[model samples]
Target: MDSSSEITFDGEQRIGIQKRSVRRRFQALLEELTVMNVQSVADRMAELNPIEGRSHFCEAVMRSQMQFPQSTNVYAALVAAINPRFPDVGYLVAKRAAVRFREACDSRDRDRTETAAALVAHLANQAVVHAALAWDVLMYLLTVYPMDNTAAAAGFCIECGSMLRASAPQRFTDIVGGFRRLLRGLVVDKPLRRRILKLIQADESMFEDYPAIIYELDLVEAGEQVTHMVSLLQPIDPEYSLDSSISSTSEIAGGGYGSDEEVSSC
Candidate 1:
């Protein structure tokens, strides 16, 4: 072969080898990541207590999520695995998924919205039913994504009420009262409203011991009075007192029962 042809052939061979090498390295990285099972990582994180350990766990999960954004199963497994032990981590995953869902909704991107919604729903469903953190995620999704046909608002309310019933007596008043007040503010459809009323009726046993006057009153008035009674039980924080009930619930639910700044500091 001529010197010029030999040189060209060698260059092409070298280029092919470089491309193959890059492909192999990419495949190796993907394999390593996939082998790092999300459930196992979550289990390990549960055993960890220190802030550093929690941070590292979060970082690892977040890194995996970034690498496999399309892997809804991984996200679902991570949420389910972490929730029973570390509810805060579960909330974090749900919150991230919700953010993505919101972005898709804003852009009117149906496919992306469906993907994000599936992830969010999986996390919500996997959450421990009576956990305050789980309720928070469920409630937040109901509030923000209400217009979506697949948002499952009624089902979420039923789940929330069931969880609230199972909660401690002291917490029942706060959670139910807060939830009622939240409902009064939303412009929900008739069917949704009726479903909520049915849930409240099912929990009537909770308030059976209250004064007869409460029962005589209409649902709205009764709910307001109940909320007032519970509000008295909570220590009056001047700062929180000024905020509306919906705002307070949103802050607590979205930020792990604390302000965003407070949760982030931890």
Candidate 2:
């Protein structure tokens, strides 16, 4: 081959190898980090040069959360902690979560639905996603599929009720009141009925010492917080391909964290 062509080929090969290496490191870091050591984990994740292979990082995190529902809060905390620096990762996570929640609801997979809802609620509490998306999920479950999915709605409230209430007290009151009105005529199981009532009438503080956005996880400030307005009712692009492959041309921005311009959508 000509000298220029040979150099170009060698450079492309190096870039591809570098991307694969970054992807592997991100997956390993995610597996090692747990809720127990989230603070240090967040710091390590930030050091991973995330802008390179960010899509891969996001996919790994989402898959991890899907596989281990019990660690939902840990994943939420990680995202919140990373968001201050790499805001695009936060937006991608939120968009993928909205799509996951919708698919779970459509499939009537109660467990997956609740897991996705929990992720969305916590992300909302962290201000990684707009609160409206969380409210839409709550309203959709209670209003459209109350008989089958009251538990998911109640679970979401339990996960982030205080934040939702704090964001818009009147809207919180209206939605929960409407939920109660709907429950009046329907016959729900005793356990679910009681849980729903507690969510509606009781102070969320009584149930959990730490709010949804735990103090340790509140890494983004009010001005620095970037709320991605992804709605469950809207036609969302999950960017499923992001989960399938890493970009060969991924570049680490010099500024680091919030270095990239605002990514409006996935």
In order of listing, the candidates' clash counts read: 0, 2
> What's model 2's lDDT at 145?
62
lDDT (C-alpha, whole model) for all candidates: 0.41, 0.74
Model 1 misplacement above 4 A: 1-39, 46-70, 128-266
- Residues 1-266 of candidate 2 have per-residue lDDT tens digits of 77766534366656656766666676667767665677677788788778666776776777777777777777887888788788888888899888888888888888888888888988888888989998888887876666778887877887888888887888877867766876797787887888777786654354364376666556656787777889877788777676444442343322222211221111
Q: Over the full model, what C-alpha lDDT does candidate 1 score relative to the true structure?
A: 0.41
Candidate No. with top TM-score: 2
What candidate 2 gets wrong by more than 4 Å, as runs, is 1-10, 182-184, 204-210, 241-266
Q: How much does each candidate deviate from the true structure in C-alpha RMSD?
A: 18.0, 7.5
The 10 consecutive residues of candidate 1 with the worst lDDT sum are: 224-233
Error of 1 at 37 (Å): 5.0
Per lDDT, the best of the predicted structures is: 2
Give Cα distance to truth, residue 104, candidate 2, Å.
Answer: 1.1
